[model samples]
Target: YILRGWIEDRSADEARGLDRAGWATALTDPAVGTALEAVHDEPGRAWTVEELGARGGLSRSAFARRFTALVGMPPLTYLTWWRMTSAGRLLLSGDAPLSAVAQQVGYVSEFAFAKAFKREYGIAPGRYRRVENARAAS
Candidate 1:
């Protein structure tokens, strides 16, 4: 309920004219925020440090340093985390097959996708979906 309320409040804030930049004001570094936006916008893309750094107009080393300092992890680590998170969201909200979801989240192989998904969520993708569906129904 608390998480739901926070999502609602953030939606309300957007409705009241807060843009993405406004929403990201809590982040200290604009460059880090830029990198975040890039990753969120294209979690399926095969992103590299050089590419993300270029998006933020910083050199690779500087971008990695600032991103780790501000975001608490390296950029690629965050990218993989986001990919898994996006895949989980797709699982809950859509009827796409596991293979399709895996591809959409940047995995070419369903086995690899399932392995990573289990690593993150502690359940296989199908089981995770079933559990979340049951919870929602209840």
Candidate 2:
């Protein structure tokens, strides 16, 4: 959430200087990309939809429709993808405990994170990390 918020805040600062003419060039601008990157950092930050929509000065409904048109996936789907992606990074990074990694990525339960992680990677997180590290080391 801190990363996402930083992205949102950074975008707000950048957008403050952009004009209507600039917005006309894009239905979803660069800030949307930044927000999307933040989402990639933590897809389970359930507030991303509301947060991203608010960043664009848009209502949730409008944001949903526009986001779908531009990003080709609804905001929630993107969020899920982002969360799973981040979880993959944590699993591969091998620097954090599974429970700690889960909490950092917004999963409150180690079991819950494991379930989701397996769903995404087709293996348990610990084994997945070990395999990846061994492969890289080789």
Top-scoring candidate (TM-score): 1
Candidate 1 has which clashing residue pairs, if any? Answer: none
Per-candidate Cα RMSD to the true structure, in Å, reads 7.0, 9.1
Tens-place lDDT digits, model 2, residues 6-100: 35444543554423333233334654554565565545565656788777777788777776666556878656545665676667766789898
Candidate 1 lDDT, tens digit per residue, 14-40? 554444453344154678777777777
Compute the lDDT of residue 50 as modeled in candidate 2: 72
Task: Please give the CA lDDT of all the candidate structures.
Answer: 0.77, 0.66
lDDT score for residue 135 of model 2? 94
Scored by lDDT, the top model is 1
Error of 1 at 64 (Å): 0.8
Residue 5 in model 2: lDDT: 42
TM-score of each: 0.79, 0.67
lDDT of 1 at 93: 91
